[model samples]
Target: MTATLASVPVRSRSFAFILGSPRSGGNTETLARYAAEGLPPDSTSGWLNLCDLPLPAQPAGPVPSGAEKVLLDATLESTDIVVASPLHWYSVSAATKLYLDYWARWIALPDVSFRERMRGKNLWAVTAYARGDDRDTEPLTGMLRRTADYLAMEWRGALLARAHRPGDLEADPAILSRAAGFFDPRD
Candidate 1:
């Protein structure tokens, strides 16, 4: 007798992560955790660990692969999104860049526009850099801003932090405080 595998239904959550870096104990993960702390308990959140997912290179045709569609769908369904990343060569990590490239597929879909799906969605960025210089984050911030604008998502400010070494963010009180403000904005 052959047994068929059962497909578990995926949960429809209100929040999700578009994580850029795959490394653990990095600034990106730290920042994501901080931002998540402020979210209401009832809201469901999913972390799309970029390292675990197999995102192929950009396709040549108009239709995006099934994998790309799933990713876009997950983000579109979320009410609040946090794009977490660490600075790589003064810009976002390659993993995050690949994911963002897939957005073009969503834009090409007829009757379901990328702008419409992302409209009114609250979007925030969290970037970690090794340098204390605040300007080091300009490239990443600018890229994120442009991407958010293209997607028609609302820009909800960014949380930037500096860490000299791995796990250094834990010792930075200023970063922690800034993170708190980003997650729970008083104004």
Candidate 2:
């Protein structure tokens, strides 16, 4: 994946790296963890693995709270947001997909400000597939980009890693460095 970002003037840059793989030790999670290693020292950053959260179905309230709220808040508060997931048959993992589905509910809230709040943030993605071909990830990337467009966020590209098994990314020093450098402002 290319390591680049939109040339926007970030007032207070921050990154929220999210992991949506079902396996806590999955390659997607590994890459995301390593990628966040290079975040600017002064930037606010956090990593949330969605596999650990409970996606309960509930109607929206005045102030959305809990995991969904935390994630939405982080996505809004940060200048950049990284969404990482393992491609599950040309689509994001179930957890990631479901988390995104919450956007629908959030937008329907009584005092919904979800769309307005998400405007202009940079949305990045990190995904992996056993196929070892970037082509397999195109659909996912397109979905992410379209989602960003729909939310009025910016699509800042993606890291499409190749992993045949767990810990594969850890074995490639060059890829590991590139992954981490995604967040490195110094390049």
Candidate 3:
């Protein structure tokens, strides 16, 4: 059964959009932008697109780059974070996963911990899949939930939609409405 979003609460929310698409104007980014539009203007929003900021593969013991640190800090400090990605093999896209994997550096450091940085933060996952079946999303949802749990963040909710082609989500009213409702600050 499709879950209802009426119970979700939003107040003084700051959002960070972890966009996973290699292309800047892809469906996932578009959907994320749409969701962010519903938030109050006072709320801070940051967009961290992996394609735009590619980190080295598994840096040897936290190769701290000022730009990456700034982006990561902004995401960690946000009150609300929306992880938006296109599905890859029924899971988060590699681009997004790579960004997430970098979190390991923070958690592994002796002085810094993900729990300390992310505690009490609200987390949301927005996934776009070509397949229409809800079952296809279970693994992705579980992965996201586990990530949130590890960071001691609140798993606010998820917004799942299907996009078979470019701009498909925009043409689908049901999916658009559901997404808007799920991410709506007033809802």
Candidate 4:
């Protein structure tokens, strides 16, 4: 029940991609990269693998430091935010969920208009799953839309692909076409 990616007019925009899966070089990462293919190198902020960073102590605890902070900084400056995660129990991975949990901290950071900064920015969800119930993607998409709504950001729909294993996307012509056409500016 994942929503089809809207055929909106494409315009070059800075994007910071967050890889939510813990497995390095996995299909989720590959799919996210593919979805971003239309964005030029300079327009893309590059991918940040959350699995490589330390998780915050608690949801209400202080924000993460070092690499996580750098990721946050990049996100703060980006025009769009893309969250790429593998389906775990019908939802995003622990890494992606925890990273999002930290947003509460940003919303409360004193002297920093973090939430305000996020306002008006576009939020996109990208994920891949196995041959299981693709219907599982529905709840996750709802969660993303709600999150974006709460943050006052625009919900830009999602690019969902089914890949049982790494490199499987190579055979998904529909997904490949969707990803390839994502950034092409149309009249």
Candidate 5:
């Protein structure tokens, strides 16, 4: 039998939801939250809204900024990192891009050992797009998959939803239902 997310003990796993949506409580966030519902009640879930904590366009070289440190700490502490970013212009939002850019700085910091630490961590994505098919979200997915490969992190897959309006996802029972077991460990 396959072990599910809920079957895993709390101490062995933690989740970090990095919300990169421009607005809070959007479709992508909702989808990710639905998937998170499958976790055990005692699980540690760190919800970081990129909209609230924006990353500066410029990196502070090797020294991390306050916001960066907050994000960095969460990233390092999690066993799973769910990037909940809406598909903007067929890709991730600006805030999400900036956050990913910081990874380069983190890798070059000499003392941070960011890449080494990220190894074996699970990387998941939740993205919603309008006016297109699955191919539209492929670029975003590819980027994330490549990132996971580069870091030696496990590519745990993605939750892609089609949402044009603010509440489109909430109205879609099928997508929401799929989300319920999105994190169930697959063989």
Candidate 6:
């Protein structure tokens, strides 16, 4: 079921899908949605489109009280954070970078306790690249791994898929099958 970041009550398992693609319904977003299907029936999932959430690139100071604050709230409230972005130059999209950059500022807020609160939470990624060896995605994955390690968050791995066109993922059964189990908890 669809849930909003603000509407997601403090609960057991809530996920926040932060879409970083400039366009909607792209391969990366589709993969994330498919992965969300693997969540338990009672789990709640929220979608936050980074394209719609404009973050200023000013003198680089404290976190603003607008969309950034909303994003911060969503990040803190969710048990798992899914960063969905199309591979850009073997790394995350600019929008995704902007969103992640705010974490540093938030961590220094003193009152937010952002780093401590992020500990134990899950960090996952869903990304699609047009062409390249599978290993080419290492830069993106490695960055995420480092982010998780720094925050003491659990590295939940990633759902990496190959898709060139917009609807390529929708037609790929193998990728679909992989996404079906992407979120299944490992024992």
Model 6 over residues 1-187: C-alpha lDDT tens digits? 7898989785568899999999899899989998888886677889999988878874245545878877999999999999999899999999999899989888888889999999999999999999986798999999999999999999999899999997788889999999999988541
Model 3, span 70-129: residue lDDT tens? 657867678888889888898888887877787777677666566687888888988777
Please give the ranking of all candidate structures by lDDT, highest first, separated by commas: 6, 5, 2, 4, 3, 1
lDDT of 1 by residue, 1-187 (tens): 6555555553333878888786865777878788777766567788887877758885645665466656777887888788888888888889888887777766778866777878778777888887757698888888878777877777877888887676687787888777766756342
Every model's TM-score:
0.82, 0.84, 0.85, 0.85, 0.90, 0.90
The number of clashing residue pairs in model 4 is: 0
lDDT of 5 by residue, 1-187 (tens): 9999989874557899999999888888888898989865556788999988888888765678689999989998998999999999888998998989988888988888999999999999999888788799889999999999999999988899899897898799998888988887441
lDDT of 6: 0.89
- What clash pairs does model 3 have? none
lDDT of 4 by residue, 96-180 (tens): 8888887877778785588899999989888888977668798888899999999999998878888997678898788899887
Which 10 successive residues of model 1 have the least lDDT summed? 4-13
Which regions of candidate 5 deviate over 4 angstroms?
Answer: 1-11, 40-42, 185-187
| Model 2 misplaced stretches (Cα beyond 4 Å) | 1-10, 57-63
Give candidate 3 misplaced runs (Cα > 4 Å).
1-11, 60-63
Model 5 CA lDDT for position 122:
92
- The whole-model C-alpha lDDT of candidate 4 against the native structure comes to 0.80
Residue 73 of candidate 6: its Cα lDDT? Answer: 95
Off by over 4 Å in 6: 1-11, 59-63, 185-187
Tell me each candidate's RMSD, in Å, in order: 9.2, 6.1, 6.9, 7.4, 4.3, 6.5
Give me the runs in candidate 1 sitting further than 4 Å from their true place. Answer: 1-13, 60-66, 185-187
